[model samples]
Target: MSAVHEVAPVVDAAHAEPYATRDEYAGAIGRIRSAAEAYYAGADLVMDDAAYDALLARVAATESAQPGWAASDSPTTTVAAGIAGGDVEHSTPMLSLDNVFDGDELASWAARLERVLGRPANGYTVEPKIDGMAVAARYVDGRLSQVATRGDGRAGEDVTVNARLVAGLPAELARPVTVEVRGEVFMTDADFERANELRTGHGGTAFANPRSAAAGTLRAQDRAYDAPLSFFAYAVHDLPGGEGLFHSAAMAAIADLGVATTAGPMAAITEPGVTATTTPTAATTDPEATTTSSPPAGMPLCATIDDVLAAIESLGAARGSLGFDIDGAVVKADDPADRDRAGFSSRAPRWAVAYKFPADTRTSRLVGIEVQVGRTGVITPVAVLEPVQVGGVVVTSATLHNFDDLVRRDVRVGDAVFVRRAGDVIPEITGALLDARPDGATAFMPPQVCPRCGGEIDRSQKRWRCVRGRACGAEESLAYFAARDSMDIEGLGDKVIAGLVRAGLVTDPADLYDLDAESLAQLERLGRTSAAKLVATIQGSKTQPLSRVLTGLGVRMTGRSMSRRLARHFGTMPALQAATVDDLQRVDGVGPERAATIAAELAELAPVIAKLTARGLTMSEPELPTRPAAPGSAEALEAPRLPLQREDGSPMTVVVTGSVPGLSRTEGNEAVERLGGKSSGSVSKRTDLVVVGDGAGSKATKAEELGIPCMPAEEFATLLAQLTAVRLG
Candidate 1:
């Protein structure tokens, strides 16, 4: 394990001094807790689990050591409350079930239940424990009333607005009686898969697990349960007197009322440790009302819990075949009368506990990282980690995600990154112990050139990508050339591109025009039949339509939709190439800046087209996309060039070098855009200005070499303020 390796401390706050005052200690606890709650809601975990535990321990020790320093928020006196942002006022407090790790622990817990209730449980209703948020939903009369989370034990977030969006929480109850049903708010296996897929599609990070997935979704501001988050009722609370319903019967009632639930209490009969009461205080009030007179003499058989647990275990064994996810089995006492007798604790009822199954864990080393450019032009850096055993399976490399992550984590070339797997899935990084850093470790730097095209790289408000965009002469060109909106070259995929590239027969798009049968025969996998077929395919690219040719050129911001609009706007390649930005803006859908980009692109590619013509490449200029004639004007005139302007209408191209306190390298570009200026990715003689922050080495020196005006980030900000004032005045 990487944990065993010894090295320097990573973010080591371990030896740091403790809080000097009690109030500070208490305040720290609240601060840490708030951070944890917000972070768990949507963002990444800021502090590791162990770090949090250590903080909690520190708070407890401080509160005990100095009684005068004790405050209301002290960890010693108060528990970390559940998230309070939810508006859900549950029908009853959503209580937490006791947790047990092993079989022996489960049995020992069951034994304790028997002692408290004075008899064996009659039967148990075993169901697959849903790995999700616990929720309690209430229906007043015939309609949905309130829904809340299992917040710190007593209070939870009021997520009624969001809860009402969930599929299982019906607006109108089937039975028409006042009912409060409890269930797990979860994302289904399919739903979890789809959500992650959508996240991947949107160039966002994938969620870790279904439980976290469900929780994160609900915690988002301005989002509702209208998404496909699923729910299944497991327990219920109903009754004016709060004394009549049995544990099994209430669950059965929940099922009958249109809430999907497990078949509870198939066989069972120990009296339970608690009962349902609809009153606000019934949850806390009734539990402490009953008490045992004396300790049990022998191994007391459960009266309510025994049967309930037995049934629960049987259901657990059948969970996998039934098609769902489960982490453990729940065992609660059945006898309503005995449950009231055993009373309550601060967090959970005395009768119930979850018996969990063991998960496997193993460790591996990280060896290397590889960069992958996604479909949306976002470049993600994936680690080619050292192969290792985890969760009883062999695991190799995991993801480092992106360049920003690479810089933030400070993961180096040779450091050992911990990989962990669970539930038979690919391994992922759980920890990076810098103490385990190896000698000669080098920081990973993102490539300034495109890994695929060897073209200049640039960053935008969204992500970093090849500056060449679709114009980059690379494998992406092959894909674009073969796509439906382009040349419609069928059967040319990545494998075909690979075969051609490796054969030393295809580098530029023009190389495809020079392929021969003799060169094809030398390929490892290619036969004479296939060779001729590929050669024939290359020759047919000449007959492609004008729209296809335009899209196939891989123009930036010109996808199928944009291509169609541009095709209709100019109607011909010559017209498009000659049309100025002003003429472009005159077209229906093309904005002024978009027209400028199009004009610039046309001018840029004119040489490329000339080269193809000189080489005798087919030039099938079609009458398609012909522009409409304007009175006393020429439609084919060249567009004039103008300087790019910032958001505040100032002409500027600010180049940022090094790191800024208020912005990331990427965010600085946005800041420039917000100030009404353009952000140039590179520094050259023509560059208007450069913002140099800390670590200004290569780019700053380059700016000096180019004789471009430069300013520190602070100075740049001051300059921007001056510019803003000038514009405003």
Candidate 2:
């Protein structure tokens, strides 16, 4: 129940302005609006939630100082800062709850409620505040009719079509009575992983967090496949059969009608003598939906403020194991009479207050700033921080994303800076705690030349990249070239590649083929025997198909699958290099931007490609029956379909997980493609088959859960061999 200590304001922070001037105030307003819109739209958020709250607090303080200066459209006067707009009006305004950061604040809110009620509240209900998008589901005769988002608390966009796919939100309630259920729509951890897998498999970027995934999935229509979503009702807005019920009682009723409430698994902690009541729910047949069979730990019924705080603290402690994100705890007057007495404010209800936990962020000293060159030559500034625990991980370094973000945050070496584990995964420097800055702390200077190759910097994009691209990151490119999924060169690990780069023995991947055992043995640590093996492995890669070479090349905007696609489409390196952007786009999943980037990358790597060709390396893909004659050329007739083709000639989406007997993961994927199947890394509803191997882990379990067909690795290997033998004949 202890309150997190307050942080002193930073003097040099980007949002440090006091907003005393009109221009400064206006700037803050604009920034808040932009951030809110991006957040609601499930786009990349400009600032973390903690930073946004701080900025909003500053604006609030300023507005309170000069009440006359506040405008009608001021963000303080609107829900979500007035960013959301929609056509569907809510039956009642879905007001947001005011936040309480500490026990003292919580006490003050309770006191205010007591004053309004003219007596102490009979009871309080505390529930975990699910971190998700808010939506209102309208039911007619106990059947789900429409679902809308909580846009501006007044109206929202209709999302009934997508909502029908969500789990926990039953299509029909137990009783055939009308009601408007207000709840948070969210993705569970498993759902997020599955969703990301599905998105990336389709050549789309993964969502940053579960909240973003839930928001995007809930709003998306016409998706090729449904991403799993879960719902938990917090309020029943219009209950036809139930009126003036206590808040806790209403939640219990909602649960009985086959809806999951925030009570979740922990089931509510009851007062000393009261036994928790079990809520009834109908069994669900929907595979994509979440089902709750246990009685919701009823919103712990709290008779006192201390009891409420205890319930909140208990929920916070169990946060990590909840299997979903809960940003805070919501405390509300349980008695309907008390809520009526307290009434509502313009923006939020007075009967409820949210006690937000300190965000998964901490302050640590920025010991140093190091520039790391990415595989694609993007220069990223990494903050070397004094080890600090964030989101349960000891974070020693955090990404600054780019120079612009580094500058915007104004983080300097030797300063105590704010580090947040973005999405509970990647540690990122959100901003600097400038008030704690040490004397003589200096700002970081962005590199004018590429850190690795000293090449010219391309400042055209926000992410600073080297003009030489992959060539500037020769060490990375060479390692990638020798990777298991690419050239399958066993002896050329990162250390060996680094030695080659450092000794000036290799400037590009092609140079690896030129190293003799005698020349390689001269490096600091390499023995003659090891060098010979390395040389032999390098030479062996020359026999690999053009698809492997293309994969090794690290072409921009392309991956192993895209390389395979390009190799299968063009067959020869010369044909691919000569293809225009339009020709590249003709391949599945490639758009104009990606095609143009690939075209440019191929052009830049022409000299290296020629070197590989001169070395007698394979420059052509395996001869397939369906290779295109030319871009946009009509096929004389449909070429014979391979064994793995579906009835309509489309390739089956096959996922190969774990280790296949006698075949590497790369080989397994290649075999799938050769047999006329599209190999996918993730298992989803759309996946036609899963080839399970030893220790297949989660993907195997996921396949079983989804009722997808699975074949043993040995069976798949035998089938692939038969297909390959038939193709060769």
Candidate 3:
């Protein structure tokens, strides 16, 4: 056995308190067991570490008060399993691979393996360990009969019901065969978003990543609710009654059975071979040069330690085209018979090892937190960090996740944080090193103002948002309205919007319908043509369909998703506006919170719509974003709308005044351009819109002073919707 882990107590609260008895000690032990289960199972922690320690201390006092009751299994007697734990299960026992940090350690392990087998080894298999949920599925007579999650090596939860739901799992076999398979259940990029959208709307918490979501879902008592999640099988134990079902054969069988098992690993393999020499080669003759030779072909490929590194490099270039995520390559032995000669240690197999490339890391200082109000009013708290170079890109900000995380990690302004841009280039703060902490750091408390609207904020489920939703938050509300499914205002540029706000003209979505060139000409960058194009686009949006109008409202708890459901259900703007909480509750996916939010938002906007309608804004169901044309109907499948704007490719057309989010003036402009748009420095009929991130000085009141639409940071999405449809042609 290895040396016992050292334990050092940090704090002592219970030591100064009362109650030194055996019964109290038992109760404390029970609490730790329960808390440990939740933490390891990937569930929320019910108690903090301090509280857990206190309990242990209390138990210790009890044991001291009455030593006879301190049994071997007593809480005070066992080691405290530090926080960090669980996954479902492997088809077969997924034993942990032994790790060796250095070449010498690896060499030691190999030496031990050879001793057990009494000879040299020839072949082995090495694969990158996927960081995800693991499960084992058993097929009986070519039909899936049982599925279980990895619990502890020996036993696991029976998740057969949920496993069967994943589309990849075949209900019946293609050939008459019984198979046991192992794989990961994951949510794709789209499913992850859809699930989180619904979760936010329903007042439920979201999982951290696909792995966490899949793991928790497998353990769910109510498997039917989240059946939409996806799964992909990788390992299989189906051969000549388990004879042909080794590593390579298992993958092929999984593919034949219709499960998209992991592809590419089995191909171009070069397991290492080890043979002891009778004597060392004479150094005087340069023996190293005698044994080494050039690679076989286009790229270098080697099988022995003599040529293994070259083979890995060639295979890495091919991974991108292989359709899987590979962090490194594993090298085992090619001959199974020879592998027996290598044997194994109590921890690791002697024949295989992993060689990984260097990971990308960057240093950044946590500057501040920026609260952004989205269309659904679920405010996302983004972290504003000092610009730092990571993977050759300058990242100025990262996600702090949510309120709970901020408190848990104790991340504060001025602290140095490590940032990582994952596979999709999404910037996130993974962890921090407290040893590197400097002085004068303080915790951040979310602002009470609507950062853009100067409105009071409301907090729910640990998220804070402006009560007015889009009504107060301009840029966000505007972009939401201008979204493809919303107003489809094509030509409005974000620069034009900022120009209007800075020059004092465009205010509210209503103001877009009232622009003229004479006033726009006065704005900083506007001349004759830009003003005319802006006015023309504004006039054109008057004929947008009713579904688009409904979406343009920037309703709380509503986005492209809720809007579609509402539009399809009501079929018209007036009907949807008239929907009550009781009415919206009947929709397939609308929960109570969503229904209430929708009803409240529509009720508040009744007057605004009445004005637009009276002015002859064309309001009818546009067939652009329809679900599928059912048996007797002709509709598009969740019809894809040419989004008035996208956050990724172009920037939102907007002007800013009074406090905006922390985005600097130039950066704010860049943010708009990347989303497929530009920014306007002033507010005018010819100008598109205005955005206010933070500290919006006199410019904000002036836009209001000019009766122009002034948007706060969050409403950028709504404004972009209208601008996307606002075009010169």
Candidate 4:
């Protein structure tokens, strides 16, 4: 166990002064160490990396100011401590890299190193800081011996069996030399998706992100059932070393031993206003250097700070194209001797620092809290924030998710809060800075009554809802009903819906048919011309197919595709209204729970359906050619054949994926349906065929795995033509 204590002071203020006492500094150091241990253990983080770095900097500054008061085993002087999972001790400490947020900080670090050396340093090496789980692998006599995770800097969990199963990690080295190699294990975005699909298929919870997926897979006891993971060597240590090689040379040596590194040769960083000298390092001076296998190609060398910045920029630009995730880039001193002279800090090497890219999180003041009623009548709280930029977008509002989250985060009006763009969209308040909170800022309580309709609130469930049902969420429902994929009602938007709801002119979708130019023209912003156009559009919507009408109804768990399937299965609104739960469940993708929900929603909306039907809306499917019975045929006597039925006299289950030439994905699914086949969004064992199109990804792979027949777009089109001809004939 590491002697460094793991606890840290919580600095809740954004601009609070540094620690004034040794106790305060010690607390901050302990907190940082604890957070790092949790992070390495794949547990929930108490604070984000930005906050962790701030506290770490404070501890470092405090130690520098009063060295006599500093503990001998302080976190600042030790590598990250290990957790209890792994029993294997590392030959050398796996130090965590210190981080700098921007170019200025990076330059300052570089300048500090040069100043310590009393002259300009030789150069620097830059590489990506892959966001993944770190592990050290030991090779004995060119054979795979053992692998351990970075449990704490000194010891890690032994995971040799699991490590051997990773796709890209080499099981054995080419040469018979005892060595230890350190690298990261990660999962690509594509692998993460596949892993989630497999997990959900087997009734398991899906992982939240790629890094978590990789970590969980590496640590799982059942290695055979774990998801696929990849590895990349970043550093190497020879057991019987003669001399230390340059960082780049060490990476090349690992690559030569049949292990894959993150990328080829590191980018070289030259000092400003100086020309880079092409001096060969010790590893390159070996007699067998020309004969030794070269590293995998395409790692570019950068000269000067501008060049390094450019390299970072280029990497950022190409981030989306990479198969794996990287949170930052590492800048390391190129000269091995210079690194030795700079020496090691307790937790990190002094010669290197990771330049972390700007995070998606930003601080903003909470101006107010607003309640919004969702289409399902659930009341959600939203934070109105003073406009702030996060993840390159200006965000004005963030979601509090629910009343529980609102209170849990303790976010209040006038409080400074940390806002982050979740998944690069959907701004959310991660936490509030209590130290910077205003004196008058008070806790916000969710309204007992619906904010929009003054309806009674039901707090019996985790998410509170309005007892008035659709009446409380009428505007939201109206907007969804008018959406392009739903009813496709033109000239009707949020503003129009709000106006109609405020004027009491529209209470439900059925009320849209009752609207007229005179009534609409009376609303704010709607003039004579606009009102006439809107009325005309509403009138035209009466001719829309049953699928659109079902989507417009806003049934829970029923979207465009499901609506279309339900419409096709029932043929008409009357048939659907009369369907039992079992009958509804017979449709593809409609399970028992969904069937129950659909049945209950339909039962509740019967009156609305009748009103819409009475108002002249189309409630039945369009007529299609019915197959004629063959003379004296026993099959003909049983039932009429649907237009979508296959020649074998059964409904074909087809999965349509990606974009098809000459037809949208929607059109492709509709084409399958028109021929009496069931169209599904996902490929499964039940699927009879998969219609693959351009950009077809995981679905195609799954179909191949299941041995389901796949057809190209042209073949599908040809099949559709044949089916149409046979149906018509």
Query: What TM-score would each prediction reach against the true structure?
Result: 0.42, 0.54, 0.43, 0.49
**Candidate 2: residue 234 Cα off by (Å):** 14
lDDT tens digits, residue span 157-224, model 4: 89887787665467766678888888887776556656666665566545534565677777877634
**Model 4 residue 498 lDDT score:** 90
What TM-score number comes out for model 3? 0.43
Better of 2 and 3 by TM-score: 2
Cα lDDT of candidate 3 equals 0.52
Q: Best to worst by lDDT, what's the order?
A: 2, 4, 1, 3
- In model 1, the Cα lDDT at residue 677 comes to 49
> Each model's C-alpha lDDT?
0.55, 0.75, 0.52, 0.69
Residue by residue across 355-377, what tens digits does model 2's lDDT show? 97766655677889999887778
In candidate 2, stretches whose alpha carbon ends up further than 4 angstroms from where it belongs are: 1-367, 385-396, 413-442, 453-456, 466-472, 494-503, 524-532, 623-640
Cα lDDT tens digits for candidate 1, 631-716: 22343233221222422333376788888766666456645644534466555434688889998987787677556778778876
After superposition, the stretches of candidate 1 with alpha carbons farther than 4 Å from their true spots are 1-42, 46-91, 197-205, 223-226, 239-243, 264-325, 359-729
Mark the regions of model 3 whose C-alpha exceeds 4 Å error after superposition.
1-129, 132-241, 246-380, 386-394, 402-404, 414-426, 448-454, 479-507, 514-534, 547-552, 555-570, 578-604, 623-729
